[model samples]
Structure formats: C-alpha cells, structure tokens
Target chain A: MQQIINFIIRNKNFLLFLLLFLLALVFTIQSHSYHKSKFVNSANFVSGGVYNSVNNISEYLHLKSQNQLLTEENNRLRNLLFNSNVNADSTFIDTTKFGLAYKFYSASIIKNSYTTKDNILLINKGEKDSIKQDYGVISSKGVIGIIDKTSNRFATVISILNTTNKISAQLKKSNHFGTLTWNGQNPATVQLIDIPVNAKVTVGDTIITSGRSSIFPKNIGIGVVKDFEKDVAENFYEINISLFNDMTNLEHVYIIENVHKQEINNLLDE
Target chain B: MNSSLILNISRFIMLVLAQVIIFNNVNFYGYINPYIYILFIAFFPVRDNRLTLIFVSFLIGLTIDMFLDSGGMHAAASVFIAYMRPLLLRWSFGTLYEHQTIRFTTIDFGPKISYLILLTFAHHLVLFTLEFFSISKTILILQKTLFCGIFTVILSIILSIIFSRKTK
Candidate 1:
C-alpha cells in the first residue's frame, strides 16, 4: 500500500495527463464528423484496399455460384434478344428499345452500411466516372440506392434502407403509385406511404419504380407488397414491401443516369 | 508567493480569453493560425506541482476547444506540452531549471529564446497534425505546422518580453 501510494505521488503528472488525453481523444472522435476526420479517409483507403484483395480471393472462391448466376443472366438476355422481337407485348420492357434517354454505368460497392437510420453505401466509381448525385443505383436483382455524393474516386449512396430516402414506386398490377420509405427496423422490409385506400393491392403484388421522377426510369423492379394497413388519416395505405436485393450481401451495382433529367427538370421549373 | 500564484492564475484566464476570443479569429493567411494561447502551458512556473500544471493546462485547452469547436485538438496538444515541459526545460536551461522557477522575464536571453521556440514548435506541430489527422497531405501539413509555429513563436516571445518582470 505504501509503495503504491509513493508510486502514485511520484508519477502523478503522467497519470493525470494520460487520463485527460484519453478524454480528449474520445471527445475528438465523438465530435468530429466521420467524413471530416482524415483518420476515416486513411482508414477507408486501407480498408478499401484490403477489401478489394479479399473480394478478389472470394470472387475466385465463389466462381461456381457466380458463373451460374452469370449464365442464367446470359440465358435471359439471349431469350430477350430472340423472343423480344416476336413477343413485343411481353411484360418486360427491354431497355435497349428505350432509345438513349438512360445510360447505365457499372460500379462495385466497396462499403455497405445498413444498420443506421441514415445508412449509406460507398461505391468504387465517382465523378470521374460520370456519376453524379441523385443517380439511381440497382443490382441485377433490384433497386439498391441513389447516389448522394461523389469524390474523385469514390461515391456514397443513400440506400433504400435509410429512413430519409423516399423513392417513387407503384404497384405493377394496379399502377397505383406511392412514396417508398424505410422504417429503420428491418433491412428486408420497407414501407410505402400515401397509397390511396381505393387502390386494389394484394399480398405478393409486384412493386416497381413509377418513373414519375427523373431519378429512375419507369418499371424498375422494387419489391413485392408483403403487408399493409390504414394510416392515421384512414385514407392512404401504409404498405410494407419486402426488398428483392439482400442489401447486406450486395457486391456489384449499376448506376442509372437519366440523361434527360435536366431537360425535364427545366420544363418543370417553367 | 501567494501574489505570484494569483498572478499566474489570472494570466492563465486572460490568455485563454484572448486566445479564443481574439487570436482565434486572426486568420492571416489561408492556413496559418496563431495559437498564442499555448503561452499558458509554455511559461507555467517550473517548481509548481507537475500534476496541477497538467490539469490546469488541460482546463485551459478544453476551454479554448469548447469555444472554437475544434474537437479537443487544443486540449490534447496542451497536455502533451505540459508533460514535456520539465524535460524540455532541463534540456534548454541545464542546471538553471533545477534551481529556479522558469519565468520568462527572469530567464536569460539565450535560454529563453531556445525554450520558447522549442515548446512553441512542439505544440504547433502536435496541434496541426491532430487537427488534420492525415498523412496524405504531407506538404500541406508541414506548411501549416511551420507557418503557424513561426507566427506563434514570434507572438509569444514578444508578449513574454513585454510582460517579463523587471530584475533589480
């Protein structure tokens, strides 16, 4: 006991400094914006590089499953190319037939965060690759997010799972449009608001982007209606949609840029 | 002796007030920010309790950080210099540090300049590095550290000389 007290007295300054230093460090990290911290940037660089290498290895490991998926996609494309001509009235609207109003840019998701109220996904493409804010991003399965911000070599996306994100969507069966939003509770489920009570909606009905906004083209698959209930106003239906893409497992994504966005926006302004 | 302690405490408050309210707003160049508030940690009485010195330095730094919203950079740098003051004083003033309080006014001309410059430089370097927290902007970091250090060193020396007690 005597020795411990002597030691404390002897090096009290160092101990005090250490304690205060830790408090200051915690304050620093807690107060600093995640993007503002150069620590986060360097950490992103290091982690991005590591994830790239790990993805490369895992890509090799999952070759069989990936190849099967690719083959299935290829077969679907071939079918579309051949049968699309004969069955012009098919439910699927081949994008190639839609002129040059929309362009698709391929990007790989480097970081995905779905556990927060305002979750964001970081992609490898950025402004240098012609990506801009408000660009709609989707995977082969379904819609993922919209581009929020871009640096030189990277872009961040506001994911569909985010509470603040609202995408315009409609039912494929009834064509009744509503505002899609996330409840921040389930990654697999999102809610559609302002759907009029009169709309004929049933469980498992397909939901898709309405093309009302210039962000996404019409008929982009969103999900299936899982459940719905009357809102507080008793006029609109609060629909629950089960997302098709497992947001947590996304690896590759396609950014959709509507080239006519500005022209349409300008017309609306007038 | 009690008067001197009161004077030191008052000086600490005055310097912190000046730093946050006045000097912090003086953004001369794009990157150069003069941290003259570190004067409190730089010239604290040498024979004072080391633990008290560190705690006091922390309080001063924390006060400045709260005003500036700088996320504890000032506090971290202040504690660092407070801890290093003893070793730096022994290095700069040799035996003089062992016998007497390191008041800027009573110190010799040569040792005073060395002590002021070294501590000012150390404080500025740590402050800027923590504020930036990145190694990629090496040139920008060095540019900021050197310019701010030079500006702070000049201001601190001039202020200390002006405030130094007259020797008989």
Candidate 2:
C-alpha cells in the first residue's frame, strides 16, 4: 500500500494528463457521433454571448450589403405575389386559416464555420424563440442547415457543408432523389450520391429538397448540378452542386418548424 | 509570479478571442485558416509547473472548441503538446534547456524558428487526425496539416518577434 501510494504521487502529472486526455477523447467521439454531449457545445451562455457581441460589431459593418440582400429578396417575393394568377370570381382563400404546414421565424447567424470537415453555425434564436433541435434553417437563397442543439437563447446548426450531415435532395426537373453531402473540400459546392444513371441529369439543372425528411419542407432550393460522372460500377451517378447561398458570408436566415412532424412520425412508426 | 499569472490569463483570453473571432473567419484560399492560438502554448513560460501548464492548455483549447463548435479536438492536441513540450524544448535548445538558462527572446533565430515549426506541425497533425478520424482521409489530413502548419508557424514566428522584449 505504501509503495502504490508513493508511485501514484510520483506519477501524478502523467495520470492527470491521461485522465484529461481521455475526457477530451470522450467529447470528440460524442461530437462525431449523431448524439452529441450537450454540455460541451457552443449553445451555452458564455460562448454564445461572446459570439453575439462580436456579431453585433461585424453586422454593423455589413449593413449596406445586408440591406441590398433584403431588398432583392423582397423584390423577388413581390414579383411572385403580383405575378400569380387569381380568378376574380373565386372567393379569396387564406392559406393559414385552415392549418399551416410549416412555421418560419427569422434569425441571424452569429458564427459560421465552413473551413473544417465538420462545420457548425450559431444562430441568435433558441428555445425562448421556439427554436428546437431538428428544425430546418435556410437563407432566402437556399438551404443552410438543420438545428442540432439549442439553449435558452442560442442554437447550433449542423451546416450542410459538414461531412456528417446528409440531406434528401432531388433533381428539380426530373424528381430523381439522392443524398446530398459535402466532400469537405469546397465551401461553395456539395455532392449528391445514389442518383441513378437513368435520371437524365445535366449540368446547371436545379436541385431541391425532396421532403423525405421531417425537418425541411418540400421544394426548398439547394443548388445546381455542376458536374457528374458515373461510378466505376455504373450503378449510380455522383454529382457536384454549386450552392446558391455563399455560405461564408451569410447573415440572415429562417428557422422552419414542421407542425405535423409528430403526427407524421407516429404514422410512419405504425 | 503575480505579473506572470496576469500575463498568462490575459494571453488566454486574447488568443481565444483572436482565434474564434478573427482567425477562424479568415478562410484564406477558401479552406486554410492559421491556428494562431497555438502560440499560447508555445510561448507559455518554461519554468511553470507541468501540471498547471497541462491544465491551462486544456482549458484554453476547450474554450476555443466551445466557440468554434469543434468538440474537443483542440483540447486533445493542446494537452498532448503541453505534455511533450519539455522534450521538445530539450530537442530544440540542447544545452540551453538542460542548463535551465533558456530565454525565448534571447534564443538564436535558427533554434527559435525550428522549435516553432516543430511545435506547430505536431499540434496541427494531432488536431487534423482526430478531426477527420478515418484512414481513408490520410491524404486530406496530411494536406491540411501541411498547409495549416506552415501558415501557423509563419504567424507564430512573426508574433513572437513582435512581442518579444529587447534582448540587450
């Protein structure tokens, strides 16, 4: 017993290092897996508050560009509203009167990272704002990511650029679906796999969400097919897509809540 | 002792902020960002308690991880380097380290540069390996380590020179 105690005391530094290293490794594994250890994340108050303050100063410097983006989005929305055909004799119908499928709340991105293999974004909204995990986040230009974790006043989004993130996407014209993933090489581009060779895809064809998942709604723009090649086995076509949103410079985004998600999930479970 | 403690605390805060807010967003060539924060561990006083250095390294690394949302990759790498720093110092400084007469500011340019390069590369290698965490990404891991290591070493050298007190 005396020898053991002496040995432990002598090697305390190594023992402490081993203990801390193992703890850190546990955090790394938890984060890599689908289920993250929540306490170690950035959605908490201290880190989130720091990001919020920094974003405020940077956001001020970006007012001109942000205003320009908002104006363009507004113009596009106005065109869609005024250009739609409505019969004069038909009674006006309110879409939200019956039930809304998805609810949208606007939020700003405080921190966005795309240079790493696993990227995450911090948004200004959280549980207090009704934001929750698995909610879909999108910019006006395209899909951004899915909310992964939320605190009282902040949330962390698993970006589409993350190698671990996979979204159900389809070719806009032909409705052929595949999995959208990132190669971790380029921030502006992502890859789609499992697209069949017979899908009749071409460069510049639009890609959109397939609505197969409960998070994002149908028909949200993702990107355009940039290039493609058949796998060696000739079974599937691997495609690269150029994103519409310059993810590196994002500011404003919308968090989407699927109202019927629980019902749909229950039905599928049966 | 008091002034050194204050200096280290301020350095910890400044490096964490500079890393997440400034360097994390630099995105040179769309993918490479220098991990300048490694300098915190690099410039830490050599005579401090090894256990405290290890703990401080883990704390700073975890703080950066929290802001960047990168889990504990930084913490693991920082701890590993802090543990190995004694050996690295011996290897780089030879007689100076053995005699406990080394001062970073007064070190020869060759040893100083080599030490920074070696430390940066080691940290980057461990960080990228744990981050990618797959055998298939060997090429990618090496690519990132090389590019990021070079950038980090360059920045660390420049910062050291700028911050170092006059030797004379």
| Top candidate, metric DockQ | 2
What is the lDDT of every predicted structure here? 0.76, 0.90
Q: Mind giving the per-residue lDDT tens digits that candidate 1 earns over A1-270?
A: 999999998878788999998887766664444333322221133334543554565556556755665687679789889976576576987778776999999988765555434566668887789898889999877899888657676777778976668889999987789999986657889999999999998899999999999999998888998999999989999999999887766777899999999999999999
Candidate 2 lDDT over B90-157, as tens digits, reads 99999999998887767899998988888899999999999999999999999999998888888888
Clash count (model 1, backbone only):
0
DockQ of structure 2: 0.74
- Residue B61 error for model 1, in Å? 20
TM-score of 1: 0.51
Write down the TM-score of every candidate.
0.51, 0.95
**Can you list the residue pairs that collide in candidate 2?**
none
TM-score computed on alpha carbons, candidate 2: 0.95
lDDT (tens digit, per residue) of candidate 1 on B102-160: 55566788888788888988887777777656587567667777888889888988887
True contacts kept of each: 0.44, 0.64
